[model samples]
Target chain A: MNNHENTAIEFNQVSRHFGEVKAVDSVDLTIQDGEFFTLLGPSGSGKTTCLRMIAGFDHPTSGQIKLHGRDVTNLPAYDREVNTVFQDYALFPHMSVGENIGYGLMIRKVPKSERNRQVRAMLELVQLPGLEHRKPSQLSGGQRQRVALARALINKPKVLLLDEPLGALDLKLRQQMQVELKSIQHEVGITFIFVTHDQEEALTMSDRIAVFDMGRIVQTGTPSELYERPRTSFVASFVGTSNILSGETAQKITGSAQNISVRPEKIRLVAPETETADSFCAADGQVTAVVYAGMITRYTVALAHGQTMIVAEQNLDDVSKSVATSRGKQVRLIWPCSANNVLQDPE
Target chain B: MHYKNNHRPKTPKGLLLSAIGVLLFLHLPFAIVMLYAFTTDETTFTFPPPGLTTKWFGVAMGRPDLWAALGLSLKVASIATVFALLLGTLAAAAVSRSKFFGRESISFLLVLPIALPGIVTGIALRSMMGLVNIPFSFWTIVIGHATFCVVVVYNNAIARFRRMGDSQIAASMDLGADGFQTFRYIVLPNLLTALVAGGMLAFALSFDEVIVTTFTAGQQSTLPIWIFSQLTRPRDRPVTNVVAFLVVTITAVPILLAHHLSQRDNL
Candidate 1:
């Protein structure tokens, strides 16, 4: 981990309250320089509020926010060295694309000639050359998003804050823009603090993801770590599809493994009469239902104890031949001991 | 789909009749004024004038008293419009965007003059000016006009400001521009059309104001006051019609122009 001194943004026990409701509660986080950090949460989880505070749009009710070791807790938004791409893009409809991109430079009192040059370069950088004369109303959703990005990046801010920037786009366009945004961030080499409720988007773009719940950070880690070793049930369910089984800790099999969390894909299905004894732990059940997805077959198995378990099988050749025939039949479900992930119970 | 189809209007004639009625209600008075402006008769209005002539235009333009009154009205309206635009925009920005105490009450007071009847406001202003011992002059007329005119500008400016998302301001500030710089480069440009429309509307309102102007102008005669005085004089009948016609044209042009500008903004 990078030291706190080298961090681009550091929130020291920051808290914000809106009337009696705590929107952000004592969050302490360090975003490293030139890294893509994401705050992921459900609606009203306070991710956007935290982003607003960092952008200087909202001041924390208590605690400090430091940018490059300088306290900026009280600074107004315009005084901060950061720019934001809002969810709606919020491009000025009255101004042409060039004027929108040139606004920051004009505000900084850059000479007209230099501002024009920089604006032209940024237009080309966003692959939107010759769109200078077009108003925002004339542009498509993706084009307007590009113009917004260009407008923000033209100033080369120390930190770029994106509040659900791709939320307004169609799914296909959003996926494409996510790649473009990640590449753009890489090229600019600025710290990006992104906020989104989309888990797939966070997983695809962030160097580290912070999961928020009810105004507090529940967990923070890399995409793989968050998915494979989610510390809590909320993180596990939020990040990916997981079939949760309510079971007490049966026993501590070893010092390192305290609880069991088996991924569906890890379980192997076998006919009850043809099971290998030493290959895995066994659970016997009747197939309650079978569903055929494009890439996989999902099965709901009912155990004798009335517990239901979900098992997913990759449809390598023919899904019909592999799992379709087992519907309404008793079967043995098996998985290696290593397939289970042990997680601490959330308080 | 079936429900929507069943409820669809069956009588296109009814729709046409209502549309025509609304159009006539809106434009009939203006059309009458335009028709009478060219009348050659001196005593009373007739549907078809004896003959169309520019005689009244000539008579109205040739009077020095009428010219002086027009000039004074223009002077007062111009001063009031400028003051209203400045103070109205500032007050709008403060109330619309800032989080401060008494915001709702301040906004309410800003719009109070317009909400009340013109006679009430005029009477109140007359009493206040008398109590303060301030002589009623062009400045007093400007102040009275501005009380209502500010509401026009404030409504326009505040509506535009609220429609503007906060992100645009944040983005500009984040790019290293100060508050003034952000407003100048980002905010003002967005607000320009609305401000112009509001100013034009305020100018129209101030230019044609009679009830408030009468109470505020102690000795000075604005164009409306001049026209009101001429209504009682038999010798000045044609001239009064001409001046009234001119006042309507002047006021109507700015208001129409402002409407066109605001419509374009919506588009």
Candidate 2:
């Protein structure tokens, strides 16, 4: 009965081991109530496992899991007041959309008329106003996904655990759902613990993200903070893309550099003779490669000390002519010293 | 409509003829029975059935013994199918949902009754029943039939359970349904078609079963037993043909229905 109303979930030194494999190692985490938090990681990095633990599909091998400061490590999923939107949707193929959405209410013995009204309202909330009678198998993939969301949301649990719900949709449809999902969370005002491998999806939707690598959280911060000021090389490269400068090359760029990282977009490509102010860091190199993407162009510069630095520039100018001439030319990559983020080796 | 432009390999004419030949060889006896059920001849074999008449159908329907045997056969088949459905589904759930040691071996044993010879199963049941002092009766016959009927259901149930996966059950629990509620709402609906298909096949198998029923039904006559006993009487040939035709129809319909149900959901 220990109540911390503002804290939705807490994992205290939790570890989950599957025989010899440590799927989720000793980890301490807290997700604030009503916040859209994401666990970002590649496959097998324990993101989904962590989400499952929160939803009570999995239990910690040691330590504790608390929902609102009440220990729930030994509780089964049915006992926990949390719901999950599964990655596969997991909609019952035999049930129609309305039946699936109203299942939780039916279990609670809510009156039939009330259940139906709530189901219809949930369908509308998910933007699927008239698909209540269609079976899960009859709907398209995205429609099935919406039904799954509506089903979990109808119960109105304290927290919603989503395990890569947008992974199966097409890119265009995925982007659309991402916005819808964020808005739905905002409207519902329930804590959402989302797990995803896509960094852009995490950045676009989550209020804060915990980056996971090798069964541990590498860093946790706001999307902009994680992207701009990564604490480790793993977080720097994973959240977005960053060029890590270390050893002698880093030492020459910034005096006595143990390790430092700067984003590719942060460094500007200029003439080799460009003068650097005291507030800026500059490196002279030959442009070894030019990759012209639709929205941006990337230049790979080979420094005199043999370290390559990537510089990305927005395609604001007519860059097609410059793309042909940029390769093999001497260039100076310049960025304000504030753009450099000091890095630490991952544990 | 035009297969010549299709990329699939053309089916050879010889293969098609041989397939037809095999089907004819397999079903030609049933077609002969169908033809003779309407024969005018009361006794002896005759080509082309000599002439056709609907009298044997009426005659077969009039016999009290035929009705009694048919009723008993239906009763035994229905009861045996129910038993098979319950036991087989439990065994399938246990084997498919858990990872206990010897899971594979246990499932293998569950299906062994059907794989073994029917005579062997009959003898084993008879010995066990006698050892337990359980007198041979209608219930004994049902118990005997259910042994192999369970195997048919187990196969169907296990395959469907594997395809259904555990995600829906997990989803059910996460949505606040307890274990029994999850089974009733989530597991049962998903398993309905598979169970129906399995039960139908079990009914068909149990309906015309003679060997096990013969060993278990002491002094009683089921439809199959009556048909087997009538084969020795020359006067009852025409009536026997009609009854055989009825038996074939009764068993064939459910088998076909089971096949249809099982094949409908490949997705």
Candidate 3:
């Protein structure tokens, strides 16, 4: 056990089951202090369950959880020094913005004047200044989310758990909140455990991320580390899009009969007869389909061995080497051999 | 509240006539009762009275028996409403938040008192009181009224609990509040409006309740029991009409208030 004050939260083989369904299987992990860590997974991957157990809203079916190096598995949420920003921004509809932000302090029986001052300060931090008198129902979705953040942050908990806090916002607002939330986490210097299924969000703001699947933690690493060197097929395919190669094609590409992953962005478009470079692996294929996505174009290349790979390239201003107009053209797919990540053998 | 653009106000002529006809059919008798309370003649029905006077209202107000019955009814209804609010909210919170064995059956049983024929509930309560050798009195009337009032509050509160969603409670807990604190700070506020709506409806129903009260009250004289007995007496007819008007107003106020309170939440 690496129990220490620097570790904000640690799970020791914690598992939770609801009768027939195993919501979260035995999992071990540690979140360090003042680090922005994210749990990334699709729905039903048990990431939210893990966050709930940490917040003390749930108890593990077996094993233990420690908060700030103290065993809090049996502790209630009120006793735990952790707060959460919910997905729907669960602000009290009846209370004004200031009252909602000041709720935690009010519950703690803080002085009225001090609570108001702290609420105002927290509101300013979230950039929703001087709107405390307005009801949550009257505010827009983005403003309500900011109030939720302020309310949770005012408690000044050791760790803040954000469960898809930006899920309710529109695309533009979500991107904007992403940057603001990251900066606020840095400013507050609280250990943050953010949960999201959006891989881009995880990659953008997280100092490190844990990928989950089927009630287990598949991999844990920095965003680039997981993106560039996923140790398993699920992590490789889930973190960012990857062209998975196995069987004979895997042997031909890397001289080993092992599953490997090559990212679509890593493959470059080259001439049909280009000679393979010492540092890069090369293969010949026919461009079967092209998909235009405004700034970039993706080509589905069907190799000689009946395997298909998706290759994406920037749609530069020069129109000559464009994949959009290169349909049915023979091409060579090449990427640095070092870019290919060998995944563990499938069980 | 901003539904002006969505209004489809052009009702068909046939539907409009039918709606008006239905409203009049339901309310015309109550209007007649109000009209009779002001009739000058004591024992006769007239198309237009020789003179309309407020003398019956004065007579009804002066009677000591009438005051006693009104006081008893108000006391019973208030006590019944209090018990209903407590037990109904507890039952709703349990059924809505936790999925345990027999949850559906418990919910169905909670609503059974109101759904079944009042005579059936009266007979059931009366027989149980008899088997236990419990004397029928003011307390029995309150208990009888509470049986159905609990259903009213439970129905309203349970629906609100479901619509309020589960995340609000989770959010409260995650915000450093325990179960009691979560209820006080989060759950209670959301349900306060709903509880008010339910409590008012329960009060209105208990105030006007007649059948169950008759079986439960052995010697106690409630307002409805007095009204029932007075209907058989020929001399106090106009006074009975005046008291009926007062009862109708007392019951109508809470129903309308509950409607207004619950509707405001939709906005």
Candidate with top lDDT is 2
lDDT of 3 by residue, A299-330 (tens): 99999888999998987765555644789999
Q: Evaluate residue B201 in candidate 1 and report its C-alpha lDDT on the 0 to 100 scale.
A: 93
Off by over 4 Å in 3: A1-5, A318-325, B1-17
lDDT of 2 by residue, A1-347 (tens): 23487889988999999999999999889889999999999999999889989888888899899998888998999998899999999998888999999989999999999999999999999999988999898998899999999999999999999999999999999999999999999899999999999999999999999999978998999999999999999899888889999989899988866799999999999898789899999899999999999899999999999899999999998899999988999999999999989997854
Give the DockQ (2 decimals) of all models. 0.56, 0.79, 0.71
lDDT tens digits, residues A1-347, model 1? 33656689998899999999999999988888999999999999989999999988899999999987778999988788888888888787878999889887887789999999999999988899999999999999999999999989998889999999899899999999999999998888999999999999999999999999999998999998998888877887898766455543223222342545667887878878565556466677899899999798889998766667789988888767756577799998887766666667664
**Range of the 10 consecutive residues with the lowest summed lDDT in candidate 2 chain A:** A1-10
For DockQ, the strongest prediction is 2
Docking quality level of the chain pair in candidate 2: medium
Q: How many residue pairs clash (N, CA or C atoms closer than 3 angstroms) in each of the candidate models, in the order given?
A: 0, 0, 1
What is candidate 1's fraction of native contacts? 0.82
Native-vs-model 3 lDDT? 0.90
- lDDT tens per residue, model 2, B160-229: 8999898999999999998999999989887888999999989988898989888889988999999989
TM-score of each: 0.88, 0.91, 0.94
DockQ of 1: 0.56
- Ranking of all candidate structures by their lDDT, best first: 2, 3, 1
The CA lDDT of each predicted structure is 0.86, 0.92, 0.90
Ranking by DockQ: 2, 3, 1
Give one digit per residue, the lDDT tens place, for model 1 in B88-117. 999999998888998999999999899999
